[model samples]
Target: MSARLARARRLGALLLLAGTVQATPVHASADQPEFTVTGAPADRRDVITWGASADRMSNAVADRGYRLVVHTSVAGRDLRVRLSNAFGDRPVTFDSVYAGIQKAGAELVHGSNRPLTFDGARSVTVPAGGAVLTDPLPGRIPAATDLVVSIHSPDAAGPATGHWMAMQTSYATQGDHTAEEGADQWTEVLGSWFYLDAVTVRPLAGTGAVVALGDSITDGWQSSSDLNRRWPDYLARRLHAADADVQGVANEGISGNKILADGGGQSALKRLQRDVLSQSGVRTVFFFEGVNDIKAHTGVTAQDLIAGYRQVVERVHAAGKCVVGATVGPYKGWSEWDAAGEQVRQEVNAFIRDSGEFDAVTDLDHILRSPYDPERMLPALDSGDHLHPNDKGMQAMADAVDLNSLDCDSRSRTG
Candidate 1:
């Protein structure tokens, strides 16, 4: 089975393992750090280098430390990480947090590990459903480096919030060893991203970011794990080497997420503000979703899905940001696919290509579908299930995107 398909199934029972500790999200006391978000300035250059969307974690833990390794998309300085508790029923208090450059398994590059502060405080407490963006650390973070974030919470218990199906390797421990730069103490390998969701950096004044908003494909299910082969990762590399103003990339794809309703995660319509709009220095939204809704045989018409896409475009426009829509690719062999679903997919693709409602469009369906059978994915690009793409397909999708369209008229409302 492809990792893409397994990831979707993993979501159903994630809580079984993480189903441990924590109470409702809580506000910080005078001495306790609070969850506070000071959005990046409009005139400056703060861009997201790495991102993992938040989802409900049925499990919680106390006195546990996490060593999360994420690949940076854009090179910049003043690194910051946003810790999330967006799904916790109880408050979470992170007693220690550190960031560094990874050397070997669980080991940090010498002299790179540094402590992080939330508004000058060493510790922070996120409310039942809130997040805290850390004060920027002074230093330049190189693009494409394996950035590791170490975290420890003394009293995390209850339903927690985090990202499942990370498609990357992270580490965890039973105690607060966040300050250590060695690997001995961090032995447990974890697949999910806990607490932290977004990382940002300040690059050249004019440089910005493009957020790839979608499902498993964008999340990089079939792509090589721990190697950052997602379509967005490829896009980031392209942006970096090119002479474009948009250099940042955030993958906000959830495994089973849909555009119209909640299931895999919050519906795209629901998460746009928090995931897409809130990211620092985002210039365009690369919208690619709706396959889940279409395949489920829920009686969702192409018109219904189109309406959902329109809603997203309108909301993003209202925020003054540009949106680039991508045509949904073929998924003829997946279990739920039927004649009715194929028709819906065709109509949706037609609208994506012909409709000018989006600021711009990328014909992903055209690029990924088999010419001989438009309803089926090309064998070479298909990840076997016919719904998700392989590494080559991901690269094709990223390469298909026009670099100029990402800026959306010289970045109208982008941060």
Candidate 2:
């Protein structure tokens, strides 16, 4: 997809007069130098309030429509939706796309559903390993609201891409139901999010964002399903309450992801650019990975993980953003837990705390560890699996984070 199309082009005055199309909102890409949308005012810049990392997908049905439901983290207007074909083997064409507020179940709020366009056209084609951002809708999306993005692809197949573990209930149906506000025909229930990857909004100046990069725990494994109880979700709520400047939160965690190697998804090093740096208004990246690599018994040492962490920190610093390194949480009861892996985890956590390499440090290990036995996770917090945390534990991890470290104030001091 061309930038003019992938990144929604400005709606000219003539088009506005003709009422042929609405304005699409464009966000800064990794290659793009600014966070501000082209031709947009300086004060109202787009920031990523919600995002899900795109991963390899199966079951790409032809002539199918999906109504993906996602929760936003910040209050903002002129909302934009991003659709990805990142892992596709060929081009995919979307003839219709719509954005609206969820009323109940699969139904959308009356009169809130509106069609989205790509480059002043109703349809757009996304090439292999590319994405498209729809034009902005002229309205406000409140914080902690469920936003529905409906999309229809007439011929979509072959190695599609999306976040497989949405932890929310989305809907699917046959044919082009993108513009429908009623839930009558949307009968399929989907556990994973398809096609749609991100949602950005124009907010007041100085409002920033933080992206949490991690594994299954951060992916909301044991946290209650469909409740938005992920640690990052809790942190987003905190950001909105105490800090006005840094209010956006993007959870980029993929289940089974490793920091130094690729398995469930691209390794942290390989995906940093797209998942973290490319996101607009990202003042910091809260690094919370490496559990998979260490617990998998893959011959991954503490030094190997540290090298990867250093590379990530250098790249984030180069992009002029903060990296908040987190200590790996305890996983004593899990089958993969072993003395050698425990030793490696301790060494890595020590470096994360005392090395002074990261811009900020969030001692998650200190927070989640048991008082009686420091090497194991606290039983009250453990979700019975001992590796992942329950709702209470997830909230505890979010509370452990110093929200001040997530803003640019720390980055300013470090830089």
Question: lDDT scores for all predictions?
Answer: 0.81, 0.81
- Write one digit per residue (lDDT tens) for candidate 1, span 296-402: 87889999999988888877776567899999989888888899888898899889888998999999999999999988999999888889999999999999999
Among residues 3 or more apart in sequence or in different chains, the pairs in candidate 2 whose N, CA or C atoms overlap within 3 Å are: 24-135, 25-135, 25-136
Candidate 1: regions farther than 4 A off: 1-44, 410-415
lDDT score at residue 50, model 1, on the 0-100 scale: 88
- Each model's TM-score, in the order given? 0.89, 0.89
Best by lDDT: 1
lDDT of 2 by residue, 1-415 (tens): 2432322233121111111011233343343212211212222267788999878899598999999999999888888877878788888899999998899989999998999887678888887766777777788999998999999999998988899898999999999988889999899999999988778887655566788999888889889988999999999999888745678899999999988778988888777776676666677889999889999898999999999899889887766677899999998888999999999999999999999999889999999999998878899999999889899999999999887787544333233
**Model 2, which residues run further than 4 Å from truth?**
1-44, 409-415
For model 2, state the Cα shift of residue 308 in Å: 0.4
TM-score of 2: 0.89
